[model samples]
Target: MTRVVFVLLPEVHLLDLAGPAQVFAGADGFGQPYTLDYVAERPQVLSAEGLPLVARTDWPVLGRDDLIMVPGWRGPVLRDGPVLHASAVERLRAHHAAGGTIASVCAGADALGQAGMLDGRRCTTHHQLQDELAARYPRATVVRDVLFTTDDRVVTSAGIASGIDLALHLLAARHGPALAARVARDMVVYARRNGNAPQASAMLRHRSHLDDTVHRVQSLIDTHYAEPLPLSRLAAHAGVSARTLTRLFAKATDGLTPLRYQQALRLERAEHLISQGTTVESAAREVGFEDARMLRRLRR
Candidate 1:
């Protein structure tokens, strides 16, 4: 059986913690393989929404796990709380070093950032804190617009509801897109879109400055994720050299290389359809993966 440990702190966002718990706990097949536990610095913690959660074990006494999920912190109070212990941080680092997966939701990225797990990696948090997160973790590629990001074994999501998306992504990774889609259907959520789906959020529009070139690129990618997108063609459409396009893209976007950026968009869309209960093969093909084997590899 797989074991998942959720690290809870005072003033934690209840949904940020509960969303993922429900997804993982409801995973189908193998008799619900995961053993989920809520472990905290103590046996009890208060949620930002005023709910009380009892930890299954105190931090020091908790056992190791296949995955460690850190839910978003309450607010400035928890973020600045001197009482927020570092034992969780130490355990997270140790877990990652041992090849275990570590994931965070919403401002939970802040906790992971504090632990240095996000250094030199791509991550996302609630859009409202993107600037601060980027400023505080200069080495991290802090994405403000995406729903979530996963790199180097560290998975991070945007605010509140995005935790559901993150959890579905985890299911897809551990089991398969088929299983994830089932979970999403049972939960009545659009299937977990892959991490790379096109983001149609207002935040991205603001950051893109409504620039014609940027919009064109995004639009083209959205329409052509399944088709081949050569850099030369994309640059030609943008009226710029490939090199110039790359440079401008880095400045205009969230620091993803053009190819990587496109792939991310495709995956994001795929995950969404899957979460909405789309079949794995259909979802992969819908997102432009011609080969099911290829989609499986990339999903992992």
Candidate 2:
């Protein structure tokens, strides 16, 4: 079983802890063998939302597969940061040194900074705190306007609801995208959304619409983009005629039809694979194209 440990500091945001906690709980419910534990310097810690939370004063022994997360609290961060016990800070640093993953949400990056994990690593926090995070951790590369970032084993994300996105990413990497998608569906949320969407995921760039029909179709495409999904199949899933589905999709997404949107998703995934050193032909085939020619045309 994988042990997921949350290091709770004073005045933590309820959602920053709850959002990712819910994701792991969902995974465990699906029989993924995740055991979640919470550790804090004190027996009782108050939430930023005014809820009281009780936690364990003793930490569980963590293996390399285990995870440690720091949820953001409400503060100016640079002005008055949450006080982390020096021993707790050492646990954060030691876990990473032993080849484990460390993650943060919003101003939680401040804790990771104090643990000295963000040095020379790419990280991000909420837009309001990104400057403060940068000013405080000048050695770290603080990416702006993106939903989240992962470098080595240190992960950081934007503020608030974006913690869900960061958790979904970890689930995708640890389990698989399919299981992560299932958990997201169960939670009635999408895995990604626009913050500076173009820098995020294809799933985020085109999800700014409110039509349920278009959303249903987009969800289908998001999971099976690498498969042979024809327009008729997608339309049938949306319970609309192909022509009607095309019209609705275009109207919702500023005139990009279902086929075009699928191509965009495929193109985005292909670009990511290619950037990671996959050959154009291999990337094209992996993304469900007949060959590299169409992929080349799309790139141009």
Candidate 3:
């Protein structure tokens, strides 16, 4: 089983921790088995919301399949949050050095900095602390106004609810976008937050409607985005005629037909593959394009 360990800091922001926690926990409802472990330097950590949280002081053994995360905490100022224990910082470094994935939510990036994980990495945090984080870790590349960033094995989120976006993206990478979308749907999240992805995931982007027909069509498109799908097939799945499916789809997704939405998913996946060093032609083929022609046109 994959282990997800959360390092609880003193006065941790409740949502900062809970958002990602709930995301991972919801994955279990979708048949993804993940063991969650909470570790802290102290036995009782208080939340910014005045809730006391219990954690284990003893660390768990983790490996490459494991994920260790730091949740942001409350502070008077960006530079004034609770300082992480030396041993805790060492644990973060050791985990990453062991090929484990490390992540942070909001101001938790500060703790990762203490672990030296931010050194020469691309990361971000709550906008309020972006300047402070950059000034403190000059070697790190801090991208502003983004939900999350990933470099090497380190992932960081902007703040608060973005943690959910970060966790969902991680789930997509581990499992697949279809599973991640189901997880997001189970949580009532629109799955619209793209984090650093070039385009939003279909699970949430065109999902702001109560039309069951449109939703069914979108669900079909999301799971089979790389396949050639005609409007007639989508309409058949939705139990509607092709013209009605087109009209309802437009009404649901702000004028985007089912075909356009599928293309969006394809383009987004293609861009991600290309960024990971896949050739444009290969990426296009992988995302269902007959050739690079449409991909090139969409990219342009």
RMSD (CA, Å), each prediction: 9.6, 7.3, 8.5
The residue-by-residue lDDT of candidate 1 on 161-262, one tens digit each, is 888888898888877887887888888994465565433542244245545676677677766767889999999998989998887777777675567677
TM-score of each: 0.65, 0.67, 0.67
Q: What is the lDDT of residue 158 in candidate 3?
A: 87
Runs in model 3 with CA error above 4 Å?
A: 197-300
The candidate 2 region of ten consecutive residues with least summed lDDT is 190-199
Best candidate, lDDT-wise? 3
- What residue runs in model 1 are displaced by over 4 Å at the alpha carbon? 28-30, 59-65, 76-84, 198-300
Rank by TM-score (best first): 2, 3, 1
| Predicted structure 1, TM vs. truth | 0.65
Query: What TM-score does candidate 2 get on C-alpha atoms?
Result: 0.67
* Candidate 2 local distance difference test against the native: 0.87
Separately for all candidates shown, the number of backbone clashes (residues 3 or more apart, or on different chains) is 18, 0, 1
User: In candidate 2, which residue ranges exceed 4 Å CA deviation?
Assistant: 193-300
**What is the C-alpha local distance difference test score of each model?**
0.78, 0.87, 0.87
State in Å the error of residue 166, model 3.
0.4
Better of 1 and 3 by lDDT: 3
